[model samples]
Target: MPSTPDTPSFHALIPCAGTGSRAGTAQAKQYQMLLGQAMVMHTLQALARVPQLSSGWVIVSPGDSFEWPTVNWPDHFRREACGGATRAASVFNGLGVMLQAGVPAHDWVLVHDAARCLITPEAVSQLIEACRDDAVGGLLAVPLPDTLKVQTSTTQSAPSPSGPRVDATVPREDKWLAQTPQMFRLGALHAALAHASATAFAGITDESSAIERLGQSPRLVPGSAHNLKVTYPADLAFAELVLKGRT
Candidate 1:
């Protein structure tokens, strides 16, 4: 968890380099419009608005030459061109730059995704206060309300003329959907990512997974359901509505 001002300082990092293939647009989902501005611009702007944020950096996808003409880019951000095959790689690379640029190991590092355009100042403050203890890192996550299914395959002939009966229904338990703004101690996170990289688990989606590998469970901070990642087509519509309220 990250300590407060009286305890320790912190910095923020946003990984905008991801190519969101699930959104199925020519441009990455982060660059897609939410209202009039780029989706990523909202996410970065929200971070910039947070008074607690000491500094931030963005990692852009290689050769993505498109630049937003109207958005107010943060002065503290530095762009990195090289990103790894996985999300963990991109984060680790950014952390390296931050570490070298005078960010302390004990200072908190908040990692948020670019596609999460719905993130707001209030939500960011929630995450910051929730991460006030350094032993366990924290993230903005919402509890899962729907039942989950685990699939299994069985050998069978071609489908019969009659419809087949449905199998057992899954039960909903204590499942939570993880969101970003995942805050952690700089040294702990760096070590966790390094260990995961050595073990060849490059496909981890978020920072919590890497920390879990080190045997420490991260603390969960409640987040708004409205803070959705702009991935698929429908998300654009929802984001538009959310942004309209802001306008």
Candidate 2:
């Protein structure tokens, strides 16, 4: 895993197939305007700033009707309509497309969320620097500081009409909230995802989880809280504020 002429290069892959239903936007959340540009544009622009990233790819669903913005995209940035029904499926398909396009098996692929528009080039570089030479690659994450609660229904085997009750208080000291630009070897990640798909494991929510299936632990590089995923309507406004402050 040492970097050499024979070692594979790193590339960025953004999964853009999600509909962002929670955001309740008229258009897809990634396509929604944020500070005069598409939300995903901000994400791509940040990745474009990472010099170590040789190229970037966006995975879109087949027959996607959303039009690309007229703004000039970077030469290294490209889009493919090979997205699948689920995020894991989309990443797996994109990995296959990259392989067919001549990317090597050992090449590093940083799978990022398109909705994480607040991610910076520095954060992307941080992940790469930490994981580039490691046996198992890693991802950007933040230590969970909130007091977590395990809620349960008051009634047995059924949810209470009123609401769930706090059944337990979980320790937050050891918890770290996972974030992305989850870097892993293309071959390993593809294989892990393929295995999950074959077994119908719907819990493979992130690249790290997929990698964990192979009994390999990916490193966790500390990332800023600003690198939040835009999942709700209020998140858009928060992202805009963070972007404006950066400018």
Candidate 3:
């Protein structure tokens, strides 16, 4: 279906406040160089291609000291320095800023990961096309292909280090590994995240989780495995290779 005049505008929100300790980088992972540019620059470049997006916002730490790139940014792109300590907090805070700026509650918001530098414009467009008119919104995800194992271990064994034993094998038939640009309505997401914060829900890993708390199941659009999140040092090289392949 085509978007009508009443259809809410789509906006992009990227949370980039984390330290990325596991990445083993001296600086924040988003600012780390990838393909001769800051990693987050690639993410923003992909977002800029989505003409349907009304605007793009990056949530950064209040005291962030990293220097922004000198390249010309998209005219619709903006940055907010009200990021919080946790990912959920950062997103929620950014949402507040959007509301203050008069962005309608019913407007669609695509929350993407800054570290997912391999995310392509095609993948982002796929997500928007699938969720633009969806009642509950959705996200980009890839199904797991590897055999799953459930480990059993207890922390009480202080005498010696013991290896975890596989307790069971989980069925991967209906399982999907979640990825981003998670799309949802601004009001609904804000309410969900607020509820999570009030209830002290520490497991609010992603925006979808907060939505799930409201009993809404978001659709999972198929995404490529190449859209991997750059979590570790080795993953940076893999992302670089993917970028090179595109050229």
Candidate 4:
């Protein structure tokens, strides 16, 4: 079905410019091998199945030479070398490319993390449906199910040999762990990000933060525990186990 002004098309903007220093890999974490293929391949494959995404862009840094495989790559997705130092900048640059490519500013852009290889098609589709007609757009998130804690100021500044100590246990009644496919309109998101870029993108952790600075609250749709971002080295093993179990 073709998109109209009443129903704008959906596009994916994946910021793949991060160095992944936290993942402790020789290469970028997204390019690291997982289940015999690059971790991002799994992420891209999941997005490709959604069917609603009219186009997708993988924003990589200039001079990035990841050697992407040719066979079976999604035709709707393309790689662009306009990534920036931070995730916020990368997405902002990618949005500019989308605009230059003639994509309508009213079209929706689902900005997802490339390291979150465990994201499933159903989850992406769920987010799209939930935010399709939303006034402010939304993101996939899960309610905090465990006890929340705030560490002592001393411990936070300087940890002791005995490990950090919890200062207080906060209520988790309304807390939710934010996750991705943070969906927003192309023009709205671009404007929100442009405002943050003036301050070097401070306090702009995710796409939602940029939107929040504009006094707009994003809706949080239910997400799965399995849709974890592959951050640490140990997480790779855990993600592998989960992926293998699914197979």
Candidate 5:
């Protein structure tokens, strides 16, 4: 379907441009097998269950040669090769394409990570419901459940031989681990990220961070711990276990 304007719509913007060097995979981790399909396929399948989403766009880096799974793929969701060097850049560029394609500025965009294949439709729906009427959008997050730690400061000449011991225990109160499907207005998120583009998107780790720089606070809807991003090799095993359990 073609992009429509005026009426507010929910769109999923997934940035799938990163190299999975840390994952020890020969290809991008998103394309790596998970359960019976590609890692990102699981992510997209979950998004397809959300009835409120108008469309989903997967952003891949230019010249990405990975063959995407086409069988049973949602017609409303498609891939675009407008990815940038960093996650923030990919998101910003994706937003630009959406706007140019006639997506309304007031429309809601849920930015999710392709590696976070465990995200459920329920969690995404919760975020949409929580932020749909609010002035600023929100993201699904979980309160810090584990004790926080700060690494000991080390000098350039001398490093800790004990593999960087913890210097202090940080207060976990009021601290939350940010998670994906960060819902925000298209114009708001685009402008926030555009502000940081000059600095190569430095300090902009997530969509919420970019929005925070605009002096606006995003709401935090409680998220499930099961919604984890697959980064390391061990994480894939855990994700597969979880996916199998869900089945």
Candidate 6:
């Protein structure tokens, strides 16, 4: 793993280039308003509010605008345009930008989604501070409150009329749902992702998988349900309520 950069401060990498087809909106979901501003705007605000988060860089799509072009960014935030097909690809491109800008390897690189509008500065601070100990890196996660399920191998239990197992719910013993703003040392995370991409294992979903791929387990820092991503349109309403609480 690479060593941490001399710069101890955290920098945010918000990937706002997704089409958000699941959101069922004409405009990209990140460009849509949750309370009043664009979804990405809220996420950027939450990160920027963290005193330790010295700066922010948003990765936007090639043709698409970073946003409506009317609303201005926070004092120190900047924009970049290299977005990728997968979230990992987009992040890889942004990492390069940060490196070219001479960001340190030790600096905290937080990868947050644009749709998670309920995120708060407090949550961001928790994530940043947790990354301090080099032995452990952290990701915001919520313990499982709902029951989980593990169906049989086949969709149908009857296996073509032969005796078969039942569609049973799995025991929710210690499961946790992972959230974003996942922070890690620039060098460590970069090496992990690079190794994963080098092999045929490009299907990894989250940053945790990249760590696990390198034979290390990432620590989970508790996060609230309010940090849920805005996948469906209804999620915007939930995020609106979450935002109201923090305000």
**Model 3 over residues 138-200: C-alpha lDDT tens digits?**
999999989999776456433335567776899999999999999999989999999999866
Candidate lDDT scores, in order, read 0.80, 0.91, 0.90, 0.92, 0.91, 0.79
For lDDT, the strongest prediction is 4
Q: Is candidate 1 or candidate 3 better by TM-score?
A: 3
Each candidate's clash count: 3, 0, 0, 0, 0, 3
For model 2 the local lDDT of residue 237 reads 94
lDDT of 2 by residue, 1-247 (tens): 4444367799999989989999989988999898888999999999999999998999999978987875768789899999998888899999999989988888899999999999999999989989988999999999997999999845555776777778889999979999999999998888898899986658899999999988998998999999999999999999999999988
Better of 4 and 5 by lDDT: 4
TM-score of 3: 0.94
Error of 2 at 167 (Å): 0.5
Higher-ranked by TM-score: 5 or 6:
5
TM-score of each: 0.88, 0.95, 0.94, 0.96, 0.95, 0.87
Worst 10 residues of 2 by lDDT: 1-10
Give me candidate 4's TM-score against the actual structure: 0.96
| Model 3, global lDDT | 0.90
Please identify model 3 stretches exceeding 4 Å from their true place. Answer: 1-5, 155-162
lDDT of 6 by residue, 1-247 (tens): 3334444767888887788989888888888876677878878877778887778888888777543544556777888888877788777778778888998876778888878877889988887777666564879999999987654676543464665555688787789999998887766777777787776337678777887877887888999887899999888777777777777
Colliding residue pairs in candidate 6: 4-106, 5-105, 5-106
State how far residue 221 of model 3 sits from its true place (Å).
0.7
Candidate 4, residue 150: lDDT: 83
lDDT tens per residue, model 5, 37-101:
99999999999999999899999999899888789587899888999998999999999999898
Best of the two (2, 5) by TM-score: 5
